[model samples]
Target: MANIKIVLADTDDKYLMPLERKFIDGLEDKADLIVITDPDYLKEYFSEPQRVDILIINEELYDAELERHNIASVFILTEQELLNNNTGDAEANRIYKYTSVKEIYAEIIGKSSARSETLNTKEETKILMMYSPIGGIGKTTVSAALCEALAKYQKKVLLIGIDSLQTIGSVIPQLPFMESGTEKLLIEKSEYVYEAVKTKIINRTFDLLPPFHLSLPSLNIKGEDYINLINGIRDSKDYDYVIVDGATGFTEDLSRLMGVADHTIILAGQDKNAVYKLDCLLRNIDCSDNDRFVFVCNKYRNNRENFLANGYMTNFCRVSEYIELWTENSASEEGVLTNNRSIQKLALMFI
Candidate 1:
């Protein structure tokens, strides 16, 4: 049985059907969702002595008397544009009716539980690290898009960016100005980075840890720190998927950290320099578990001749030309992922 029970009261049978399916698909067994379309049934359902963790009700059907039921939380969904409607019942929530289901579900989860409290309650979190042997090839774009995609599909996803170059702030503009999660975690050398980082998490499509505020070299975050931090999240087991977004370029330290991931996505192009750098990195790293890596050829031109480089090939995870990050001038790219769909195939690799 799911640990939480959620009741949704709405008279639209068609509207509730898809929301029920979406809840089933995204939450799986984490939340038991009940949809009541009949107003009488909705009243009777709540009248019974039942434990409902959350109640999302249509404003028309909601009665002030229902507050006596002591429901854990009650959210009123309004179809009209109402201003300052949170006037009564201070604990009640007023939500616009047309928001995406994923956004609503994300908000519910953010309010229902704390990351630290979920430790040991979830299954193992699969860690996927995104890296680029060459810069300006949509690593951040792919990672951010994939994070949202997974959250839409499963509703439990965590995104951690270690972008010392500060590109993630531009890529994920919702990110609250830097919180130094890296410095705080390393200073205490704590095993609670997952919990500590999520305290500042916004209720977006997915929860993102405020990325490393300082340069990695300044803090000297080593391979062990990476292992401990990632393993801590895995052991905590709060998320279904954990996506770690890497910064520009590649290095031995970066490669060593990539080794910690359950699956590693290395982005490159069809150029000789990309092949040379990846080849060198492969030679340096312990490729004993070779199947863990996914080499992606970004900005792919569909040229078969360019695909064959130094006897190696990369999976083409290309973004359209409209995305300004295709070249080395990623600084000009903003909101490239607003309508991007190329990341679905990449998201399927983990799902």
Candidate 2:
């Protein structure tokens, strides 16, 4: 578990005093704050590689220092200032832009309900599924990144790898496991689904459930069987998020998982085949009215513009905001996730 690092940049010492105190008071032991007014030291702060989670910047200092640093930042202003500027439009997701010191405290505590839920009520682990039809995109990457993000505020998050072949490189940088298999659980056929479902939980929160032997050509599981397994985990009242890294294409198992999912995120690569597959999958899915769904475009390039112009999406999830982060000059060379900075920023976006 890493501590929440915050950078506070303001020119006035009087304004900076209360903001620093409020931040420390809000998060207590959970956060660390660095106050800076010198523009020269801005590069020095970010150059250390210890990515700051949130940057609380005054409106006056925002434009000068905001030169595309790798961090999740929020403009710190007075309540009157936020309303005057109408800063809420800049907020990408569930995060709220705070106007006052008190509001900042509320944002930190409000979003962090997973810990409080355990103390007050029987916590129910909500399962989230990240699924898509095509491969070589960012389904697996998004799943892993979402897990990393959710783990920021919530202490308990499990990223399960249930794809057919096996998922090895997504969560963290690692050497391939020679015999990663979910076959043992299949063979056990236990009435206790927990025993079967729970395996290889790494980092602080993520749990990895290995797939059947990768060497094998095919792997299959019934739709009902997957639902039962997920239900058993949900019944435990332990984790906050049960994120499923699904297999490519629409399978019975995938449908079962998606059907039960509270929120589903579909990743579409900027490719013609991927678009076609996404269209077919959306048409086939029998989703309920209340289910939350979203579309994320990965490896975005000129093809994305073409896809949007063609009006690709047919049903479910909004495609208004396409997420494209990885750049070609990145270390991965394949335009996939290669750096921790992008990974950390992505983690914050989902969190």
lDDT of 1 by residue, 213-236 (tens): 667667776556656777887887
Clashing pairs in 1: none
TM-score of 2: 0.58
What lDDT does model 2 reach? Answer: 0.58
Give the 10-residue window scoring lowest on summed lDDT in candidate 2: 91-100
With candidate 1 superimposed using the best TM-score fit, by how many Å does residue 115's alpha carbon deviate from the native? 21
Candidate 2 residue lDDT tens string, 156-220: 67766666666545434552352445544553446686665565444533555544445323544
In model 1, the runs with Cα more than 4 Å from the true position are 1-121, 180-182, 249-252, 286-290, 303-305, 309-341
| Candidate 1, poorest ten consecutive residues by summed lDDT | 315-324
**What is the alpha-carbon lDDT for the whole of candidate 1?**
0.66
Q: Where does model 2 exceed 4 Å of error?
A: 1-107, 110-122, 175-182, 196-200, 215-224, 286-290, 302-304, 312-317, 325-351
Candidate 1 positional error at 259, Å:
2.7
